[model samples]
Target: MSAPSAPPLKLLPLILANAACMMAMNAFIALLAPLARTLALNEWQAGASVTVAGVLWFLLARPWGRLSDRWGRKRVIATGIAGFAAAYLALAAGIHWALLTLPGILAGFLLLLAGRGAIGAFYAAIPAAANAMIADRTPVERRAAAMATLGASSAIGLVLGPSLAGWLVGGGLVLPLYAMAGLAVVALIVAIYGLPGGDAPLAPRDATPVRMRDPRLRMPVVVALVAMGSVAIAQICVGFYAMDRWGLSREHAGRVAGYALTAVGVALIAAQVGVRRLQWPPHVLIRRGAVVAMLGFLVAGFTAAPWQLIASYFVMALGMGLVFPAFSAMAANAVAAHEQGTVAGTVSAAQGIGMVLGPLAGTLLYGIAPAVPFVVGALMLASIAFWVGTAREPAVARPADEAA
Candidate 1:
């Protein structure tokens, strides 16, 4: 089938809502180390907070996707947005109290963990439903480009979040946290009022459950795990890398980290723009993007100057922007209409698992030596690129419901 003339107008609200949430989340992540210091927590503790939240995200994302299939995308998406707003506010409040009251290290650590865990559990709903909605509307031949539009929303968020946080952080660390909460509120409003209403079409009760190890999904799942795992590790460590490698102060490191992350976001947007124009098949995009990402990591592992480090981050994210949409399109095209929701959820679950492993492993390796993790990450990406290039390309087949 030929692609649609244009995506439906209803996609605007979903795009806006997802962008807002992504901005809030990435902003917080960029400022994690500085925020951890303010709350009297250590590096390990901060990393643990991400690990716990990722655990919840990984465990629940599939179920939430399945729920969206039954409960309707708008309702599930709205609930997720509402929960995101509430959870962010609660986290901000907890941080404020910890700062004022001088909570013990353990108390402060647990507070951040609980707050992040709550946010992750709900935030999983937003992306899964939104992606499934796009899958519902787009045909197989156009799937990658449509998915690229959604990925662009995330890239925009990544761009705005760290840039805004870096600017606001000069006022105070807490200021950025509050700003994130405000974005969530705006997203919640859009999700409630702007998205289409009514139920998603139901699938049969006995539709085969999508599994992580399914033949159709195995390569995509592996790609999600490696790509996201590398990104998470790099993100969680960049601030510390700035401080230690460049000899910047904590505050200065925060600023530098923000700038570096903003570079990543810009590159992501640039690459996705290429994806839209080039319209490469899923296999080609996956293979080429992976090779680019591996080169970026290799540069990052050995760079001697701050400018070089930032450049490497830009290169890395540019490649990721290509890989994400391509893999998502591959997975969606491999599944049936009724299975879109579950597939999207399973993809997210794989990403969550990557998040869970990346930070924990990254931090530990960093403690041993700053460059070790990046070098290892480079090798992992190289391996994946080779694997993708050697594998046979999956045939894109339209589902009966979609063809009709």
Candidate 2:
């Protein structure tokens, strides 16, 4: 007889919850400039507002993952979403008060920072729990597809969040922020009622804890660092590049950036959906995707036209879409079942580091030259592709005890 499979219903809540979380996160991101302007803050302060979240996410992801491992996936995820909703509401209130009756802009800025920090702290739990849950339910052979499904959901949310925010911000910035909070509340409800209550440990309760130094995890972790960093570099530099190269106004450049990012999101969704159906090994996917992305970046660096840049970004996005899910699957497979949360947290922390550094590096490079950041990003990705392509896949330990 065939082995029993995970019910389709079980995965739905995870997908929806992930989508909602990402949507809320990106909505805030989409409104950052406007938020800064409304509060009469400088560019540095505006940047710091967003940076606070990334910094907190980097510091707190591991602890949240470990907590989820001990407590339970559903509970942690639900609680996190609920907290995310509260944070969004708080952030909106901060902005509202700043506009209406705050003593000073600084007071509102501090409240906004606090709210963003809360979001980073609580939002960290969702991805770690969701990824660990996938690890718990999926077998090794099907893990990539499972991870891809989650990735697709996230991509959709990223796309929708900005679009929704852009539309709602026309009515008022506060409206969109509240809408994001509402979405989070809905996600919390779904997570509580729809997700499974119990999580069976991947290994026996007595299994040794997986160390971060495990050979199997090293390559994927490195890849995650480079991939996320490259993405961040590209993201941060694109708008500046558009303005400098195309001689567009800030408003026009912002719109161009949005269109380019939307192309990337569509490409990512398409590529991940396609890759999930294939049975390629993680290394193979990583190598090919990195090469494609590298090529795209190189092309983008040389492109003079707006359309050319957007098209190149789409190619890069397709490659990144494949790389992310493959790396996630490989990392999850590297350890015994019980170590999923740890590995997921580690991966999140790595990506968070990338987010923290990418902007700084990209901006510095952009000051040197318009195309320097893209060229550097391409070089980094090329090196990653070569490294991953040559590295040997480590043997994965089974979840079941050999002595049994």
Candidate 3:
């Protein structure tokens, strides 16, 4: 449990690993519109593939974190990247085969499901291990800002990934998938060579398991789930909404979605940078962000023009930028040092759960009415804002050293 001999961890490698994974994910997400068309899939069928992946992510994230505690952070990270690379390679090949062979819809959907599920099983390890590594190096008072730095890396990936995918999709839908696989391989090599060796440091007393239902984590976990669900709803529905609202073709809709998502990524980076500079208390960030995001979602639901929708997404990203890091930092601050991995994994698991349910609900809601999903997202954020702002802070949530 203790790691006296562990070398100092390099931040850049970890950043690259996290960024690469996120880029690949957002890239795939951004291209879902065109992907659905290419595969001749309905919204429900397309979303079900992601749901399967989320199921695995939710089930395994915490276990991966615990494995990091036992097997070492670097090992887990490398394993994750390796698996991601392999899965993505297979996915790209599958996409190519489907395009050429014109497989049956059920066969194609199942293939997509299997590939994504494999990626999810491995992808769960990266964030949990990476967050725990960051937590290992940071003090409680500075936790939010440190977490913001990590969030910023993912934001950078989000910005580039979709844009890259958008450009590449003109050539072929499988191009981005192949590119993602290559990136994952690079990240894998970095993980193998760039991270510190030895197991994650843990004091013997701090080695005890931290349950998800532990009182300290309860509010933070709830906040993570709701916030992630809101984001997921928008992500899943936005492409279809853009196509329907604008009367655009599949490829054009995918391009527009990419641009809008790029705005989101930029705003996320900008917000996280602000968090780094301002170093606000987690609750303040959560309350203000939730309120801002609520308004953004409302605007997105009502916006008529494609440009307006993109702007609305930017607004939403700005608020989410503050919320995501704050809640994770709050959870990290509340727990003992050894439980950092566990807490990080638990929070990720909550997000995974959101990914599962949110897309399913959003796709269904979109079928009912295009704007309904965003409306529901707005409602969820409104409740989160109300709860975070009004609820009494648990004493454990605020580290004693943190300024009120």
lDDT on C-alpha atoms for all candidate structures: 0.84, 0.76, 0.85
Candidate ranking under lDDT, highest first, comes to 3, 1, 2
Clashing pairs in 1: none
Candidate 1 residue spans exceeding 4 A from truth: 1-9, 395-404
Cα displacement (Å) at residue 91, model 3: 0.7
* Candidate 1 lDDT tens digits, 1-404: 33333245366788799989999998888888887877778778888888887898889889989988888778988998899889999998888788788779989899989999998998989878888878777877777888888898898898899999999988877788898999999999998889886546566787778777777787778888898899988888888888889888778888878888889889988898789899998878988998898788878877797889889999998889899998888888877777778888998899999889998988898898889888878888888888888876643222334443
TM-score of 2: 0.88
Looking at model 2, residue 108 earns an lDDT score of: 62
The residue-by-residue lDDT of candidate 3 on 11-54, one tens digit each, is 78788878888889888888887788777899998888888778
Give the higher-lDDT candidate: 2 or 3.
Answer: 3
Q: Candidate 3: which pairs clash?
A: none
Comparison by TM-score, 1 against 2, better one: 1
Per-residue lDDT for 5 in model 3? 35
Q: Identify the leading candidate in terms of lDDT.
A: 3
